[model samples]
Each structure stands twice: as C-alpha cells, then as structure tokens.
Target: MQAISYWLKAYGESHQNPINQKIHKVAVPGIFLSVVGLIWSIPQLSLFGFSLNWVWVAAIPALVFYFWLSISVFILMLAYTLACIGFIWSMEILNWPVLPISMLLFGVLWIFQFVGHKIEGKKPSFFEDVQFLLIGPVWVFFKQ
Candidate 1:
C-alpha cells in the first residue's frame, strides 16, 4: 500500500462508525475552512505595491509538504487551497468578520467531533499521530 493509503486506513479504524463518518463529513471541512479563514484574515502586506495576505505566503510551505506526500494529494490540496482563497475573498467582499466567524465555527465543529468520537467509543486518530490531522481532510475528500 502507498503511504497515504496506510495513513487513511489507520485513520479509518476509529472512524468506522456510520455516525462518526457523518460527523466527520461536516466537521473536517469546517475545521479546514476555519483554519484557512483564520489564516486568510491576517492583515495584508504591501510588497512592491502589490497587496498580499499571509495566507498566500503560508500556503507555499503547506503545498510543498503535501507535494512531498504524493502528487495526487498535492493536487487535491491545491484545489482545496484555491477554494479557501475564494471563500476568504467572498467573505471580505461581504464585510463579514472572518476571524470571529472562523473561531466560532471551529469550536462548535470540534465539539461535534468529540461527541461523535464519544458515540464511537474510540479516541481520535490524531491522538496517536499528528500527521493524521492532514490525512483526515484528504480522506474525506476522496470519500466524496
């Protein structure tokens, strides 16, 4: 099996419960969007008179890391990153409070995640390995 497959399988172990999977369907994307929105909410910088937020800069390292994992995963992450950027732009256009909204959603979704794990009677995979955190979103993406 490939590396990502292994990580996905291990992550899948505790997530076998149908209710847990359903919870993850919502929570994982919520968590991802929250983090992205928070990062994108950082103050913009003028570089050579070009305005850019830290989110664009920060995505480079993250994309690099994902690329090292697998090309397909890298492509998926790139698509997700672009979607997040679009979301941030839309929220800004609407004058929505990005940081507060992201944080509130993050907290609420995490609570649901814990509840789902409790229903499953198993610990989250991230407790065993931090990399599982990255694996989770991709796993959900492929499942869809």
Candidate 2:
C-alpha cells in the first residue's frame, strides 16, 4: 500500500479549486453523518440489552483501514466516528425519523458533491480509485 502522503497527493490533484475545497469541507462531514445515520437506522438487534445495528459492524473495518494508514488518521477518525455514532444515537432516542432524514441528507449532499466536482472541472478521485471515497473524509479532516 502507498503511504498516507501518496494518497493525500493523489486526492489533492483535482481539488485545487477553492470553491470545490470549501464545498467539500462542509459536504463531506454532512455526507458522513447521513451515511452513518442510514446504517444506524437498520433494524437493530438486542444483544445483551444493547441495540446493535449495522453501523457498528461497518465501522470496524473502516477504522481498521485508517489504523493501517496511520495512527493519527486512526485516532482522528475514531474520535469523529464515535461522535457521529453518538449523534445518530441521539437522533434515534429523540425519535426524529432518522431513516427519511438520512435519506434526504444523503441525496442532497451527494448532489452538492457532484456539483463541487463540476465546478472543479475534473472527475472525482473516487472515479479513478474507489478508495478515494474513504480518503475523502480523511483529506477534509486530516490535514486541514
């Protein structure tokens, strides 16, 4: 696997436009939150008196990838992921209609993501390498 810097540079190649950068800075976190919420809304199982869901299941491997990339990335993503999970939990507890809300946010934010790429005049990095999907949040939070 390439080093973290390699991935960073590759992801950075097409993100030079300031507007795209600003759009991504806001949209990516929102997207991440919606994604987690969508998964969290999955039918949960009562495991040892806990409401368990697919969100927890998915986060494990994603975090492992971050840990493999670099400890700083792992710690940052761990903290962010936990925070996102906590927010999802609160939404569930408040009965705020997590599923529909997540779906709305996901669709809207993805539109903005594509718009940002349009403004940048380049395809999104994920088109070249799917791993860029994961690298995106890291790029937004890791070095920024």
Candidate 3:
C-alpha cells in the first residue's frame, strides 16, 4: 500500500471503537475550527487594501502536504480552508471575540477526545507521531 494509505490505516487502528469514532466526528471539526479561529485572531497584514491573516499563510504547508497525499484529500482541505476563512470573516463582521472562544472550544473538545480515548483504551495516534495530528482530520473526511 501507499504511504498515505499506510498512515491512514494505522491511524484508523486506534480509532476503531464506535464511541471514539463518534466523539471524533464532533471533536475533529471543533479542533479544526478552533485552530482556524485562534490563528485568525492574530494581527494581520494589509496589502493593496486587502487584509491577509496568518491562518491563510499558515495553511500553505498543510495544503502542500495534503496535495502530496492525494488530490481528493487536497481538494477537501482546500474547501475546509475556505470555509474557515469565511467563518473568520463572519466572526470579524459580527465583532465576536476570536481568541477566547477558540480556546474554550478547543479545550472542551479535547476533553471529549481524551474521554473517548479512555473508553477505547488507547492513547491518541498523535502521541506516537505528531503527523497523526494532521491525519486525524483527513481521516474524518475519509470516513464521510
């Protein structure tokens, strides 16, 4: 099997428990959104009257990694990134505080993740390899 398939399968091994999978269904998106929000909260740079935030700049490496993994997954990540940008723009327009909200959501969702891992009787895949952190979200997309 290919490297991406191998990594995905290994990641899936620890996530087989139904409850864990269910927990991830919610937690993955929460984590994704929180990361986006947190990053978006950072001060931005304006070029030619357009504001560009770190979130968009930071996504470059991940997008390249995803592209190397698979075109379909790359497309999914692109869509996810665009959606996150839209969310950040909306939050800005609504004058919602981004940092505090992102932190709260990330912390709560991480607690749920730990609880699910406890039920599964396995540590998170990311504990084995940091790259699993990226894999987790893509794995969720693969599940759908």
Measured by TM-score, the strongest candidate is 2
Lowest lDDT sum, 10 consecutive residues, model 1, at: 1-10
Ranked by lDDT, top first: 2, 3, 1
- Per-residue CA lDDT of model 1 for 1-144, tens digit only, reads 247778778889999889999999989988988988988878889989999988988888878877877999999999998998899789989999989999999899999999999999999999997878888888888774
lDDT of 3 by residue, 1-144 (tens): 247898889999999899999999999988988999998888998999998888978899988888988898889989988897798779889999888999999999999999999999999999988888888889998885
Residue 116 Cα positional deviation in candidate 2, in Å, after optimal superposition? 0.7
Model 1: CA > 4 A from native = 45-51
Per-residue alpha-carbon lDDT of candidate 2 for residues 6-98, written as tens digits (9 for 90 to 100): 999999998989999998998889999999999998888788898778998999999999999999999999999999999988998998999
TM-score-superior candidate, 1 or 3: 3
Please report, in order, the local distance difference test score of every candidate based on alpha carbons.
0.88, 0.91, 0.89
Residue 61 of model 2, lDDT score: 92
For lDDT, candidate 1 versus 3, the one ahead is 3
How does candidate 1 fare on TM-score?
Answer: 0.89
Please provide TM-scores, in order, for all candidate models, with all chains considered together: 0.89, 0.94, 0.92
